[model samples]
Target chain A: MSEPVVATDMRKLAATQLFALIGFTVREARNKWTLLALFTLTTLFLFALATLVSIDVVEGSIASARLFGTIPLEIGNTTIPVSDAVTVIQVAIVSLLTTFGLVLALFVTGNIVPLTLQTGWVDLLASQPLGRTVLIIGRALGAVAVVAVTFAYLFGGSWSVLTWKTGFGNAGFLVAGMIILFTFLCCYSGMVLVGVLTRNSPISIIAGVGTWFMGLILYPLHTYAEWTTAFDPGWKRSLASGIAETLYWVLPKSLELTENATRATKGDALAWTPFLASMPFAIVCIALACWWFSRQDY
Target chain B: MNVIETRDLAKTFGGALGSKVEALRGVDLQVGAGEAFGLLGPNGAGKTTLVKILLGLVGASDGDATLLGHRAGTPISRLEVGYMPERRHYPGFLTAGQVLDLFGKLLGMDATLRRQRIDLVLEEVEMSSWRNQKVGGFSKGMQQRLALAQALLPDPRVLFLDEPTEGIDPLGRVSIRGILRRNLEQGKTLFVNSHMLGEVELLCDRVAILVKGKIRREGPLSSLRAPNPEYRLTIAGSDEDAARAALAAAGQEAESVPAPPGLTVWRLEVGDRSELNNVLDATRSAGLEIEEVQRVRASLEEVFVQTINEADDDKAGAGGPGGVQTSAKGATEVSVATREVDNV
Candidate 1:
């Protein structure tokens, strides 16, 4: 029993040190008014969703719906089935929420790394017993934790409202949210790396957005080039295709991750290759960030 | 064992594009346990850089440094060390207590220990009343006090403070000095980097003056400002001629200079204390009564200025771009010897 108590105490101490970064990040975000705004937006969005839609179910199916009881909605009109309509709505909701959530998380949390690198603060932290690598990784995890809490609140509220109105809810939406989070994690790793290297917030955000956009463009182009047997097999075409393929493999697969989340929501067969490939890419970016920060003189 | 030690520690910055700046040129330094050691220098003298290296905030370009017998930049080296940076700012959002708690956690203090230390340190710094106040609303002096509190929260074996009293009021500085004295009494070694000569003189057992990344002079504060082998004597106005003649007759060079009111003053340079006594005997035998005897001693500030100027002169004498290299080489050898003697 004594040994168990000592072990518990040691674990507690380790956790406190490891998660100290989360406390710091949350404190800074509160100071900057970022957390307050995020909470307020989540509340307002929930309120709107709760008030603006009305739904009815008949014979174990969503029978009728109205937009604020004014505009009538219909599904399964002759050729299209109600299940298809549900799939469409789920995909739309996931895409919009994931995309907007990523942007919001990036813009709000972008300054965390640069702020930690500020002269007086960084010096004090570096003087602690904490390793530089732990500091960097802890900070990154802290940012992720903040985003996770915010995403859970937003997505949970949306799920509750939609399930109550339509009598149709899927637990896979939560998994979809996790995938969105993983996608943001990938991009945020780049932001963390850039911020550590430059100690500039705006530049880090721009680099993050640029990385996301490169993935959005390159993944689709790579697919198109691979599938396009219609085009003549010219050297120029082949070179372009090769460059696109290389970029798609090198950069994070933001679009592909989102698509996986959508397919999971639809209960379709999922291809996790892109998701697995991107995980290593994100790890490398964070590792490089820690390396750069460890080598630098504060 | 020395609480802090560095041998041939050198750091250079910004040589990538053809303009190299050497921040520290092979500095050799040692501070014994439970000693208050001062590091003094002008701007760009590498005082802050040296502190940074010792605290493991920065890696040295070359050489070795250790704290509490562990190599610098290792986790173990900093585990028992605390540092208060110049112009330090805690996270503005945190309350003073929260900031201390966070730092305590980073130092791997358990919750119970952290709470006890937070209370003790806050009281030590006279900040117990402001424990819950947001750091953003704090004045520079208050922030400095809080910085001190955090540095002490770990109950560190060694403390490195850079201009700890820079923005504090006079009363605040006195209080801070008192706290530092108390820490020293508790047997904690202190390494202070500052340009405040008076404070250093009052606090440090020994000090080193660094100029252009090289230590120009270093030793006990008392020895750094040794009295000049010269004396000033005052005599009756009527005895001035006799005093001068007696001194010259004794084969000692003497000059009668202007005196205030009705007294005469004679300035004489002597080879030693025995020579000074001989001059007094000669004056007494000539019936020229000596009113007062004065020996001039330099102040720490004066020594600091003179040492910096002498280093500048040496740099100038060596000539051109290579002058810094020559000066650095000579100073490194001297610093090493000083450390060796100090260890003995």
Candidate 2:
């Protein structure tokens, strides 16, 4: 059969495959409610922290310093608020969001990648008329759905605060929130795609975590490579930068998306650039995920 | 025509480094319409793989097969099939009712029928009290019952049961058998994989013995019984030679041995059981005092082992000395359509 026909057939199979998955997902969520509750509480804490920092709780002192002198921090002539500037690159908030993203990824990926060492759900559904492609997509979309809800809740809370205070009534904020959520989902889907491809959960999770760690350690390597042309450090920097850039292209870059969203909402000069740049990575990651998951055995 | 037929259907797993595990090799089988045919094999004899292939769980490596006269694994074919796997797994959090309802819908049952059948199956499996209970808390036996209920929810024309009686109690097994037997009476074809030899011996009209992914023996259960040629006869006579001569005249072979001083044991070979009485009457009429007569029947287990071992011996003669051993479990059984025979 032609590839298109097969693809179409697979899509139809996927559509039919969702019913049982939805039921099973509901079951899994109920069974693991304790863990899910803890994970959600942790997420809520981050949401609370983001809201607190958004309102200038930490940087409020700096704002009060206007009694002494003019505010010194500025990004490209834009009078960035003290709280926004301070919270802009907060690694704590980034880590919190990423952890939540990981939980979402792990939860959905467990369907295909049974987190436990024992047998998984595949054995239950394998005999059914459910197609493998549909199972993977249902799982992927399920994770996306969960992540999207969290993003909406977090952003809606933030928007509520902004609406109450600064009265920023633009719906662009919601779109930006979606892009950020989808970036995580794109990355999560890619991680799950690896799980689907390997059919091993631990290996996929380790690879995902390992890549994330590597990205953190090598983030500055690119800058280091640009500044130096010397032998040892320059070469090391260049190699690190090359690896990081490749990972940057391949992995879902939620940080980049978040940065783009922030820049966009603030109407910064480079607002559209980061979001546009993120598009290629997101598209490629999702396509690769769909392709890899399509070929997965279970 | 058979409800299910396979011609040289084979499946091999693994590659060079991995052992080329032949899950099935040229398994030719046919389950006729309105017949309950048992696929009796031990565990790892490719029964599950065969079922999975029929259900489209795993693609067969080679061969062609048809179920309900349609090529296997097609949606239409699968739609007509009700399957209960050996190891039952449902979403643990779902109540038995919900589990049945979900499977019923998947099988395209209308809402009213789905609800009605779910209730009927729950009670039929004697699980009505636990219908709302989550399957996760069920014992293995209960889980098996629920699985059977789900399989029957579709009211399929063909049923594939893999170790359906594994964890069920004796009474439960009997009830499940009754349910299946009634379905068979209504003209549903059942393909069962189980290790319960006695169950199959009692239930199936015909069975196929599989070893090492190949069917070594296939026929009616009675075919496995040794042909009853040799019968025992006690005669008080000095005219044993006369009796032997008379038996011979009647186209019978009789071997005379001394059972005691006054009586002689005659090992008479006849074509059928009825001819034994005929021979005895012939001997009595010929003025030989007839004493005792009896016939022997072979146990199905003995036949099973002998048939499988002989198949192994044949294979060894052709090649090397290797015999396939599937675990004692996973052998299948079928219930008789109606208590056709009055005697057990």
Candidate 2 per-residue lDDT over residues B261-289, each given as its tens digit: 77778766677867877887787778788
Off by over 4 Å in 2: A1-16, A38-112, A115-120, A161-172, A211-245, A265-298, B15-18, B108-113, B226-269, B273-278, B291-295, B316-323, B326-344
| lDDT at position B92, candidate 2 | 73
| lDDT on C-alpha atoms for all candidate structures | 0.79, 0.62
Per-residue CA lDDT of model 2 for A80-167, tens digit only, reads 5644533343323344555564455454445443431123345445444454555555655655665565556665665565455333
DockQ, candidate no. 1:
0.45
Which docking category, incorrect, acceptable, medium or high, applies to candidate 1?
acceptable
- TM-score: which candidate is best? 1
Taking the true A–B contacts (Cα pairs closer than 8 Å), what share appears in each candidate?
A: 0.58, 0.11
Assess each model's interface with DockQ, reporting 2 decimals per model.
Answer: 0.45, 0.19
Per-candidate iRMS values, in order, are: 6.0, 8.3
lDDT (tens digit, per residue) of candidate 1 on A54-98: 666665566676787788876554343344555566677788866
Cα error, candidate 1, residue A254 (Å) = 1.0
